[model samples]
Target: MARPRTQLLSRDIILDAALELINTQHDFTILGIGRHLGVNPSSLYHHLSGGRDEIINALRERFYKNIDLASLQPGHSPWQSRIESWVRSYREAVAQYPAAIPILIGRIVDDVPTLAIYETLAAILVEAGVPGSQHVGIIAMLDALVFGSAIDAGSPEPLWNTTEDRQPHLHQAVASSSTPDRVASGLAMGIEASVAYIERLAVGPSDGAN
Candidate 1:
């Protein structure tokens, strides 16, 4: 008799494959996930004990683990550049895995692993001379730019839709178009300006007496 197949696929392995399937196919429906994984749909219950929620949790953790903050290079790169790079990294991640956005947004607050990343970001901002007063706003801006970029990339329909009569302002805004890269750069510049403004508040003239 042939030896028994002994490879054990854990939850992480299952989720990793699932995410890749979603990336390649953008299919979130139950049947799609089952077909993509090449396993009986019911078998997913073995790994994802709680169903979709379990899968989402696993994916979120995997995303946090894959983050390449090594590029931040704390001592070498200015905080502003690091912040921009961080935001860019997030945008790139979400663009590649659009299906994760909704899960990310919904689960962010409760997910300890995801919240730790934000905590690291906040600590960096504080160390970079950002006043405590502005921490909340800075975090909000970062979140908005990241999730907004993901939304834009994943669904461009909002940019193209017209409602000139009902939503005149949105129509006019859409008329003035820019490349996604330009938009991300503009957001980064805005973040830099906010940081600079805070730094200026701490600035003082040199003392010639010393």
Candidate 2:
């Protein structure tokens, strides 16, 4: 249950409403969120100067709040497991609103939570013997894979179907697979392989962007 809209509104109220809209629905606009909150669209402008971007950033902040950085500490878990945990937490958050994955990816990540995760990741990569020069490429690769996996998780079952007379081999491959999507397994192994690669390289991290 929720309280009915009132004349009094605050920035926190508006952002909570915005994230609620995003979670349950596909896309949301300023006016749409205003309507959800039973307020005039223009009223939102009094709170958010950058409008939609700010809302999305707030949504990211909300999502990251669930992630416990303390659990990802070096000694608490193996460096590889820490990486997987971060990816798992990230994917779980994004899975709540699969459509917003692209929105998050397209935006610049300057939020404190996101930056902290990146910094932790940077430090972990360094500990794993990765050169700092490759950190950008590694993060980019992980983001692409992890985010793509999240999108795939939300995809409809039977990602592909076939006609009896066409694409026999393709259909066979799909049929032989145990699940409709291999996102979970694929992502798990992908993370492991990434960790293995770093371990194999055995190169120390150099000067890097924090």
Candidate 3:
């Protein structure tokens, strides 16, 4: 009889291990991931042929997979509403793994699901009368807002320590802010500003205005 096989190690397991490393350590190597999983680094290659880069792409997919894309479907809803929904969902998904932000940003996005989300956004931008030339720039700006907000979401509460004596204006602003959820409030404001900017682009510059 053949010897019994060892415990199974699969792609999900490897990816989870890698994500754990990224979350705690802010980065991971193939060796580190394998060590976490109590397996040899070479064994990860069996599941991920492309190695570290592949793992990074996989993690990107994992992060974006949580976004609910149904509201984003082209429909009767105004483009602004769709964009807001997407931003909220994207932030919610990413904020859960804020530590992964640095690692994810370091890699160019090549994940298919993630790209599909961008493609959807691009289509919406096209429908909104945004010029094709500006699509990438708008998307980049939105990414900055969303990712920055996500990172901020993970920051310690009372993000700034201000005192009336040292910084009266800042302390007053922080204390007087009406919104309980600063991150959400700020993200909503940013989204509205971005949408307004996009609308202006759609309308195009006036003849007399400089």
Residue-level lDDT for 14 in candidate 1: 74
Clashing pairs in 1: none
Q: Write the per-residue lDDT of candidate 1 for residues 96-138, one digit (tens) a residue.
A: 6767676567753656666766776776676566667777887
Ranking 1 against 3 by TM-score, winner: 3
Off by over 4 Å in 2: 1-13, 16-26, 46-50, 179-181, 204-210
Window of ten residues with lowest summed lDDT in model 1:
201-210
Measured on C-alpha atoms, candidate 2 has an lDDT of: 0.77
Best by TM-score: 3
**Residue-wise C-alpha lDDT for candidate 3, range 1-210, written one tens digit per residue:** 976586568989998888788778988999898788887899899989999989888877877887777767766477877888878888887888899888888988788978888888897887787898899999999999989999999888889999899999999999999998998889989999998888888754322121
Clashes in each model (backbone N, CA, C under 3 Å)? 0, 0, 0
What root-mean-square deviation over C-alphas does model 3 reach?
4.3
Judged by whole-model lDDT over C-alpha atoms, candidate 3 comes out at 0.84
lDDT digits (tens) for residues 1-210 of candidate 2: 987786467778887787677667866789898889888999898888779888778778877788888887767767777878878887787777787787787789887878998898887887777877888888887787678888888877667778646988888877788864477777887888876765666464322222
lDDT of each: 0.66, 0.77, 0.84
Compute each candidate's TM-score over C-alphas: 0.63, 0.81, 0.90
Give the winner by lDDT: 2 or 3.
3
The TM-score that candidate 1 achieves is 0.63
